[model samples]
Target: MSIIIIGAGEVGYNVARKLSQERKDIIVIDKDEEKVERVAETLDVQAIHGSGSSISVLKEAGIERAEILIAATNSDEVNMVSCLVAGVQAIVPVKIARIRDPEYASNEKILGKEKLDIDLVINTDQEMVNSLLRILDIPGARDVVDFAEGRIRIASFMVEPGNPVAGKSLAELRKDYSNLELVVVAIYRDHRVIIPRGKDRLKERDLVYVLGESAAISQFLASFRDRKGVAPPTKVMIFGGGNVSLLLAKALEERGVATKVIEPDIERCQYLAQQLDKAIVLKGDFTSHDLLEEEHVREMDAFIALTEDEDRNILLALLAKTMGARRVIASINRVSFAPLAYQTGVDVVVSPPLLAVNRILQYIRKGKILNVAILPEEQAEVIETVAMETSDIIERPLKDLKLPSGILIGAILREGQVIIPRGESVILPGDKVTLVASSAAIPQLEKFLMVKLEYW
Candidate 1:
C-alpha cells in the first residue's frame, strides 16, 4: 500500500521505518532539511523536504494514490492542516494525526467526519498517562496491555530468583496451578524472544508475557512478588511539570493518591499548582539532593521522571531508585534509550513513540481485529480479532488447523465467557480470538485469517 507520512520526527520516523520494513511504498515529508536527510539516509522510504500542510506538497508526494496519510508533526496545527489538505485533495482512506492539545482532541465537532475526517487521533500525553495508570495498577509489572475492555490483560513480569515457578515448565505450572486460568504466551531471555511451548521452562530474570482474565493474571503475578507483599502505590513523586506529568498527576489525585510534582521552572510550577487540586507543586530541580531529601523521596511509593531531557529522566529515576523508592518510572522518548534505561535499574520505562505506533498499527491492520499490542523489542504481537463465518479457522479443532509456527492461540472470548484454548478447543465464528505470534509469523497469520476465496 502507498503510505505518506508527514513529519520526520521520532514518531513519524519510527512509523515510516516499521512500514518500510514491511516493504510498503512510503513517502515521508518534513520541512526540516536535516530530518529529511536523516530519513533518506537511514530508511528505505522516499523522503521529501516540504511542508505537509501545503496542497502542492501533498500532490507532489502522490497523495492521489496514497492509501494512508499520517500527520505526526510536533505542532498540532500542522498535523490538523495536513489531514485537512489530504481529505480535500484525495480523501485518503485512513488519515491519522498526532494531536497534542487535549482541547482539539476532545472536540468531536472539530475533528469529526464532517470536519477534518481524521480516522484516528493520537494524543501522546494521554497515551502515556493511560500506560502509567495501567503499570501502577499492578505493582511490579514491567508492562501491561489490556484487551476486551480490560477483561483480558497481557502482563509482563520478570521472574525473580526465588520465584516458585522460575524453573518449572509450562506443562508443570498448569498441572500445579490448574485452577488458575492463564497462558504463558512468550518469554524474553538473553536478548532473544521465545514463543514458548508446553515444555519450555521459565528461568530467573526471564521476562514472560501472560494472558488471561484480569483477576487470574493478578493472582499469577502475586506469586512473583516477595513474601512481604507489595501494595499499590499510595504516594507518587513526579519530576517535571510537562503535559504528561500533569495528566498523570490529575489521574492520581482522582484515585486519592498522594502526589507531588517537582519542576525546575518557576512559571511551570505555578501553572501546575493552579491546575492541580491535591498534588503539591514544588519549584526545585529534581537533581538537587537536598530538595529530594527534604521531600522524603525514600518514603515515596513511586518516583516518576517525565522531563523532556531523556538523560535527566534516566539519571533522576536511577537516583530515586537508589534513594529507596519502591518503584521508579521514567518517560523515555527515544526508543533506543528504553532498554538502556531499563538496564540501569528503572522499574518501568514508558516510550511515547512506541505507544503511538502500536495504536496506529492496530488501526491499520485488516480483518475484524479489535486490538493489537506489539511486545517489547518487537518480539511478538498479541492480536484480538473476531472470527468470520467464511474464515477457515472456524468450525474445527485448533490442533487440526495447522497454525503457523511461532504462533499461539492464547485466549478465546465467546459471548461473555473466556476460553483458554487446548488441542480439542474449537473456535466458532464471531468469537474474539486472541493470538500471540512472533514478529516473523504476522504475515502468515494475517493470510490465515482471510476469508476463503470460494466464499467470495
Candidate 2:
C-alpha cells in the first residue's frame, strides 16, 4: 500500500522514516522546499513540495491510489481540509491528522465521516499529557504502556544497582517465584537490544520490558527498584503553563495529588490559577536557582519540565534533579535530543511528536492491528493485533508455531479475557494477540498476523 504524509515536521518525518524502513511505498508532501529536500535526502522516500490541502497537490502526490493519507501540518485547517478531500474526494482508506488546536478537538460531528470523514484525529497536547501522567503514575518506570483497556500493562524498568532482579537469570527468577508470571519480552543493555532468553542475565541499569497483568507488573517492578526507602511522589512541581501542564495538573488534582505549576507568562499564570481549583500557580522563571530554592523545589516529589524550549527544559530538569527532586521528566520535541535528554539527569523524557505518531500509526494499521507503542531507540516494539482467520498461526499452540526469532507473544485477549501467554496457550482466530519483539521482527509479524497486509 502507498502512504502519503503531508508535512515533514517531527511527526511526519518519523512516520515516513519508520514506514520507509518497512520498505513501503511512501511519499511526503510539504510546502517548504527545504523540508522536502531534507526528507528526500535523509529518508528513502519520495518527497513533493506542495500544499497538502490543495486538490492539485494531492493529485500530483498520487493520493488517488494511496491507502493512507496523514495530514500533520502546523495549521489545523490545512490538515482538516486535506483529510476531508482525501477521504471524501480521493477515497483514501486511512486518514490521520495530528490536530494541535484544543478548540478544534470538540464537535465530533464535524470530525466524523459524515462531515470530514477523518478516520483518526490525534490531539498532540492531550496525548503528550496522558503519556506524561502514565509514566509519572508508576514510580521508577522509565516507560509504561497499557493495553487490553488497562487490564494488561507493559512496563520498562531500569535495573538499578540494588535491584533484586539484577544479575539474575530469567529462568532463576521464574523458578524461584512460580506465581510471578510477568514475562520479560526484551532487554536493552548499553544501547543494545536483546530478545532475552531464559538463561540471559539482567545486568544492572539494563532496561527490562515486562508484560503481564497490571497488578502483577507493578508488583514485579518493585523487585527491580532500589527506591524502597524513598517516599512516593505526593507534591509535584510542573514548569510551564502550556496545555499539557494544565491538563496534567488537572489530572493530578483529581487524583488528590498536590500539584504546583510555575510559568513565566503572567497572563498564562492567571489563566491557570482561574482554571485550576486546588493546584498552586506560581509566577516565576523555573530555571532560576533562586526561584526554585524559594519555592522549595527540594520538597517536590516530582518535577516536570514541559516548556516549549528544549534547551531550557533540559536545564530546568537537571536543576530540578540537582535540587533533590525525587523524580524529573522533561519534554523534548526534537527526536535528535531524546538520547541526550535520557543521558542527562532527567528520569524520563517524553516526545509529543512520538506519542502522536503512535496513535497515527495505530490508525493506519487498524483492524489489522488495534494499537502499537514504539521504543525511542527503535530497538523494540509492542503491538496489539487480532489473530485473523487467514493467519497461519491461528488454531495452533504458540509453542508449536514457527514464530520469528526476536518476537514473543506477551498476552492474548479472547472473549473479554486477558491471558498471560505461555507455552500451552493457543491463538484462536478472533483472539487479540499482544506481541513484543525487536523492531526488525515487526514487519514479519505484522505480515502474518494481519490479513492481506499488501505492500507495494
TM-score of 2: 0.94
Question: In model 2, which regions exceed 4 Å deviation?
Answer: 224-232, 389-392, 451-456
Instruction: Give the per-residue Cα lDDT of candidate 1 at 29.
Output: 100
lDDT of 2 by residue, 1-456 (tens): 799999998889988988898788999999999999999899999999999988888898898899989999878999998898777557788788878787787658888868887788889988887787777767888888888888778888777787778888988877766686578888888887888878999899888888877877767766545574233568899999998899999999998889999999999999999999999999988546888898888988789998999889988999989988888888887877977987876788888878877787686553466778887577777888767676666677777977888888888878877787778888887787788768787767665555422222
Superposed on all Cα atoms, the candidates' RMSDs to the truth, in angstroms, are 1.6, 2.4
CA lDDT for candidate 1: 0.88
lDDT, residue 266, model 1: 94
The most accurate candidate by TM-score is 1
